[model samples]
Target: MKIDAHQHFWALARGDYGWLTPELPPLYRDFLPADLAPVLRVNGVEGTVLVQAAPTIAETEFMLGLADDNPFILGVVGWVDFEAPDAIGQITRLATHPKFVGLRPMIQDISDVDWMLSKTHTPIFRAMATSELAFDALVLPKHLPNLQELVRDHPDLSIVIDHAAKPEIAAGQFNEWAANMVSLAQNTSVAVKLSGLVTEAAKDWTVSQLRPYVEHLLDHFGPTRMIWGSDWPVCTLACAYDDWCAATDQILKDLNETDRDAILGGNAARIYRIKGAA
Candidate 1:
């Protein structure tokens, strides 16, 4: 099954998407499953992992509601108040729903670079590990060290690094980012997502420009540890769903079918524990 492992659906009226402003013309409006169905169909993507766009638990519930209605939505990576004293309780409740596969802390948006290392959050991580839930690291290059520390602290947590830590492709520099990624991958338990790169590059980015970073990820993480994601609607900011899909295909064309299958869908299924697909 071909699955787009990382994507988002949001409603503007929810009013929790503080970062999604009217200034961003393409994504300022609502993006629902109906809007994405045709795109996924045309791209030959059988299912998707709907991710959180807002940090509120309300938004997570909203996505869960959508997933309940859409079989195409295989699972959800939603948000929770991880820093709250009652975070374990929240996680326990959310995990009852089979579709609640993971949680993301939006580490990149938080001002404190060392926020992940806080002692208060350690129990939350422990709870997540106990629940067998995945942790999506929505981070930037600078936060990678803290991420490394996080992996060390919670070695068994199913952590996936979103956007390859959102590399500096737009500026054509990835020395530090690459080094950090290499360090993190040494954990062997961590996984990386091949998504959101186009939006990080120049508006008219070519496949060649993205090749080095993509190749770097494949080389460092290997096909088994890497998963593909569309990062849709947000991807529409720089390229269409088809454009990103085509670009990903071109980049992975050199691989044999087994490796290609693993990167595109197999890894996501195994990592997220997404169900009901043959």
Candidate 2:
């Protein structure tokens, strides 16, 4: 069951993607599953985990609706009012839907790095903990410690750190990001998305430029804890879907078949809890 564990969906007119800019024109418009499925077929990916790129609960519901209709969408990581009084109720309700696998808050949008670390967010964290869903931290390097603490409180919950903490690979700031990643990976239960690297590199970066980050993640998380993601149209800012698929292939070409299988799909199937009859 080959899976891309971290992907996105959005409508441009919704004005939801805060990161979408004219500079990121490629991803500024609609990127529905219809636009991406062909690319998945070309890449030999069977199903995907639709991650949150929208900024509101309405967007989460909308994506959930899409997932309900789309069989290829095996799992969804939707957003919610993490601080809402009904936080637990909402997650409990959403969890009944098989595709609703996890939840995410746009932690990167908050100016204060510790916003999610506050006591205010504990109920929401605990609710997700009770439901046994992942809290996909869409955060930056600075927020890892806070995320680490969140994991500590909810030991039963899984934390999938998106995009290797969205590292600044283009600027080539490797050491600090590498250290933070190593520290986070030390948490046995935390997993990582081996996606979104193109956005961190030069638009036309060669495979060599991405080697160190990929190597570090593979070295830290190993094949058992890391999964691949397309980051899709967002990836278009740096490379196309085919380009990313090709790069991922080359980056892991040296691995044994089993390790390669784990990075590509085995770990994703296990982490996202996708049950494929094969």
Candidate 3:
């Protein structure tokens, strides 16, 4: 099954997403499964891993509710109260629902880049590893060094870097981001999502500008460690969903069919522990 490993579904009126204000007109509205199913069909994608859009347990519950109804949603990566005293208990409860696949701590939004590396989260990390959950790192380039440490301390944890650490492609910030990612790939088994590149590039971004960055990631992570995502309505801020699917095809055109399949869906199923992976 072809899986879009990273995407989001949010209702603006939920009032949980603080970053999502009226200023961003395109994404200010609701993006539900009904809106995405046809897009997935047109792109030949079978299912998707729905990720958290807001930093609240409420949002996670909402996504889980959606997953309960939408069989096409392979897994749901939701948020949890890391600071809560009973965070582990929360994981235990959430894991009871088979479709709750992972948790994403919005590292990029936190003021302290070192928040994830805190000693406080050690048990939380342990619980996630015990529960067999994936850690979706929503981080920035500056957080790469600490993220590497995060991977090291919890070697058993299945971690995937979101948006290639949101490289500053529009600002042409490549060298540092590339070097950091290369080090992460070299030292740890962390996976990465091949999504959100369109938003990072110029509004009139061309395939040429994206080639070098995407090539670097593919070379370092290889298809086995790289997963595909749409970032969807958020991606719509940059280009249409069909455009991203087309661009990804053009970029991976040289890869063998097996490698292409791995990045597209095979790896996601294996990483997220979804059924029918092979």
Residue-level lDDT of model 3, residues 1-278, one tens digit each, is 78999899998879999999889988889999999999999999999999998999999999999998998999999988899999999999999888999999888989997999899999999999999999999999999999888888999999999988899999999999999999899967899999999999999999999999999998899889999999988999899999999999999999999999999999999999996555
Lowest-lDDT window of 10 residues in candidate 3?
269-278
lDDT of 1 by residue, 120-231 (tens): 8988988888888999999999998888888998988999999989998989888999999999988468999999999899988999999999998888899999999999
Name the regions of candidate 2 deviating beyond 4 angstroms.
Answer: 18-23
Candidate 1 C-alpha error for residue 131, in Å: 0.9
Question: lDDT of each model, Cα atoms only?
Answer: 0.91, 0.84, 0.92
Please, what is the TM-score per model? 0.98, 0.94, 0.98
Top model number, lDDT: 3
Candidate 1 weakest ten by summed lDDT: 269-278
Q: What is the lDDT of residue 250 in candidate 2?
A: 94
lDDT tens readout by residue for model 2, 168-207: 8778888988887887788667899999888878867899
